[model samples]
Target: MEMFLYYIHLFARNVKRTPLFFALVILTLSIGIGTLLANLSMLSLMSTDPIPGKSEQIFNVNMNTYAGANNRFGSMHVLRYSDAKAILDSKVANNATMHYSSMVYSRRADSQDLTRYASPTRATTASFFEVMGAQFAHGEPWKNEHSNNIVIGHELNVKLFGGANSVGEKLELQGKIYTIVGVLKPWEMRPLFYHASEGKAFDKTDDIFVPIEVAIDNNWAVFARTMSTDSYTTLDQTRQINAYYIQVFVELLDDKQHLAFQTFIDGYANQLKEKGNHRHEVDNRLYNVNEWLDKNEVVNKDLLAFTIATGLFLLVCIFNANSLMLSRYQASQFEANLRRAVGASKKQVFFQGVVESIILGIICALLSFVLAFSLLALYRQLFDELAPVAELPLHMLVIGLGVALTSSLLSTVYPLIQGTRTSLASILK
Candidate 1:
C-alpha cells in the first residue's frame, strides 16, 4: 500500500515536469491506433454475409464463347431462355434459376403520363428468389402459375404506387397490365458481374421481375429471338436461340459435386460449339460463396493493401515512441543522482520509475479511445463514396479499446526498463 502511494507521487511529479512532451507522445500514438481500428472495422462489416443461410452452395454460371477475330481471348455470352430450360430440365444442375433483362415503361397509378425507366425487367424462374436469398417485404414472390404477376423493388413500389401495400394492385408495362404480387426490401444494389466488368452498373433499384415461362408465352423478344427467313442459315432448330441473353445460377451440395458439375458444363458447351452453335463462347469461371463475397462485398485489393501498409506504419510509430521514452529517461541522470543522495534505495528508485510509466500508459489509453471514435466518424464521412456508413460495425468499439490498451503497454515497456536500470552511483559520478 505504501509502495503504491510512492509510485503515485512519482507519476504526479513526472507529469508536472514534462506535460507537453507527454501530450505529444499520446496524440501521435492515438492517431496511429485509431486509423488501424477503423480500417479493421470496415473490412469486417463489408465481407460478412447479411443472411445466415446456405450461401456456400450457391454459384453463378455465364454463357461464354471464344470466337472473335483475335481468337486469343474468348468472348463471354449469356444463355437464351430455351438453352437455360434445356440445362434445367436435364437435371445437369441440382437446382437452377434463370433471369433476363429488358427496358420497360411505368407510371404512378394516379398519373396518366407514362415514364420510361431503364429497369432490368427480368424474366426469372420461381427459384430465383430462393437462389439469391431475397426476402419479400409484404407478400410472396410472383408465382410460376400466375402468368401476369410481377414483383417490384421497394423503391419502385414507392415511385409507382405511393408506398402503399400494392399486393393485387395493377400496373402497366410495355402495353401490358400486370398485377403486383410482392415488393422487395431495400438492399445494397450490386452490378451484375458480367455487366460490372464492362463498367456498367446493373441498377436493380427500379427492377421488375416476372416468370420465365410467362415471358416466353408472351413472345417477349428479350427472352428469345428468331432468325430472319431471308437468310440462308442452316442452323438446327434446337440451336436457333443464339441471340437470347440470360444468366444461369446453380446450387450444389459440396465441393466435389461443384467440380463435377463445372466439368460437365465445360464439356456440354464444347459439344454445342462443335455443332456450329458457337455465337457465344463458354468459359469456366465459377464462384463459390466465399469467392462471391470477395468480389461483391469485400474491400477492393488496393484498399486492403493500403490498410495493411498503414498498420505497419503504426507499428513503426510505436517502436519510435519506445526509443523516445528511453532517451528521455537517460537524459534524467541528474534526477537519479539527487534521489540516490537523498538515501533512496535502488529498488525504491526503480519501482518509482515503473509506476510513472504505468501512469502515462493509463492516460494514453483513455485518450486513444476518444480519438479513435472521432477519427472513425471522420473517416466514414470523408470516404463515404468508397466506404459507406453501413460499413461501420459495433465490434469496432471493442477492437479500438483493445488496440489502445495494447499500444500503451507496448510503448511504455522500453521507457520503464530504461528508467529502472539507471544506477544511483553511476548518475552521481
Candidate 2:
C-alpha cells in the first residue's frame, strides 16, 4: 500500500510537468471506449437470452407443411388453429404452448370512467404462463376452462387500476365483460424470444393474456399475419388446412425427450404427406431460445456493424495513446537516469509509470461512461429502429472500466520499458 502511494506521488509530479499530454491520451481513449461500450450495451441486450434458466430446454417448432405453388411462407412456424390443436393433442414433449398475438381496445366494466385504452393481447393456452415463466404479484391464471377470465400485465395494471391488485375486477372489451384472474409483476423479456419472428421481440409483452379457445370462438381480428394458401374471407376460416398462423414452443427436459420430440414432429409431417395434406417431404426444424433469436435475426444488423466499427476505432486509440505515452516517458529520460544514479531501481521507475497509467485509465473509464450515455442517446435519436435496446445496464459499467484499465496497461508497456532502461552514464556524460 505504501509502495503504491509513493509511486502515485511520483506519477502525480510527472503529470504536473506535462498535463496536456496526459489529458490528450485520456480523451482519445474515452471516445473509443465510449463508442464501443454504447454499441456493446445494445448488442448484448439484443443477443442475450431473456429466459436464461430454461432457454436450452425450450424449442421452437417449424414445419414445411405448406403445399402451394406460391410458397410465400417457406418454413411455416405459424400454424393454423387445427394444426396447433393437433400438436397439443399429441403431447409428445414435457410442455408446449401455442399462441398468436392481437391488439384490442378495452375499458373497465360497470365504471364511470369514459376512457378506453388500446392494449396488445396474447391468445394462448394455460401452459403459456408456465412455459414462458411468468411471475405474478397478485392472483393467478384461470383454474377452469373459460374464456371470460383474463390476465393483465404490470403496465396495464398501472394504466387501468392505478397499480392496484385488480384481479377480481371486470374489463369490458369488444362489447363483452371479462373477469381479470391475474396481475403480473414488472417483468421484462428482451428479444421476447417466444415471438421474435413477429417483429415484436424488443417490444414489451402483451397487455392482456386470454384463452386461445375464446379468441378462436369469437374470431379475434388477426393483427399479425394470417398466412394462407387459399383465399380466406374471415379469421374464422384460418382453421382450414390451407391457412397457417399460430406459433408453437415445446419444452424438452432431457436428451431422450429431445430426440423423441424431434421424431414426433418429423413423423407428424410425414403423416401429413401420406394423407396428401402436405406435398413437401418431411422437413421440420427446431431451435432453442438463443438459436431461435439468431435464426429470426432479432439483433439489429446496423448496431452490430457499429460495434465492429467502434472496436476498430478503439484499436486506433490504443495506438495513439501508446505513441503519446512514449513521448511523455522520453521527456523524462534525464530525470529517470538521475534518479537511477541516486540509487533508484528500474522496478521503482516502472511501478511509477504503471501507477500513472492506471490512474489515467480510471479517469478515462469514468469519462467514457458519460460519453456512452450521450452516444446512446444520439444513436437512439438518430435511429429510432434501435431505440428499445439502446440503454445500458449496470454490468456494462464494470466492463467499460475493465477495458480502460487493460488498454492503458497495454499501451504503456513499450514506454515503461524504454524509460526504465535509460543508463546512468549516458545522462551523466
Which lDDT values do the candidates have, in the order given? 0.63, 0.86
Return the top candidate by TM-score: 2
Per-residue CA lDDT of candidate 1, range 1-429, in tens? 897897798777777898877777777777677677666666665455534456677676655543333444343335544567766766766677866555567654445766755555777777777776667887887655447888887778877776788888877776778888888877544433322322233233336778766665554545222222123223223234444356677888787878778888788778877886654556766665556545454445666776798799779878877776777767775786587679876667766766665666566656765665676677767765443432445677667666666776677666766666666667675
Clash pairs of candidate 1? Answer: 63-77, 64-281, 64-282, 65-280, 65-281, 65-282, 66-281
- What value of lDDT does candidate 2 attain over all alpha carbons? 0.86
TM-score (C-alpha, index-matched) for candidate 1:
0.68
Q: lDDT of model 1 at residue 349?
A: 70
Candidate 2: regions farther than 4 A off = none
Cα RMSD of predicted structure 1: 6.5
The sequence of per-residue lDDT tens digits that candidate 2 reaches over residues 1-43 is 9989987888788779788988899899999999999999999
For each candidate in turn, the TM-score is 0.68, 0.94
Q: Which stretches of candidate 1 lie over 4 Å from their true place?
A: 1-17, 37-42, 49-53, 66-69, 72-77, 100-107, 110-123, 154-164, 172-176, 185-208, 212-241, 279-285, 292-299, 327-391, 420-429
- Model 2 TM-score, all chains together: 0.94
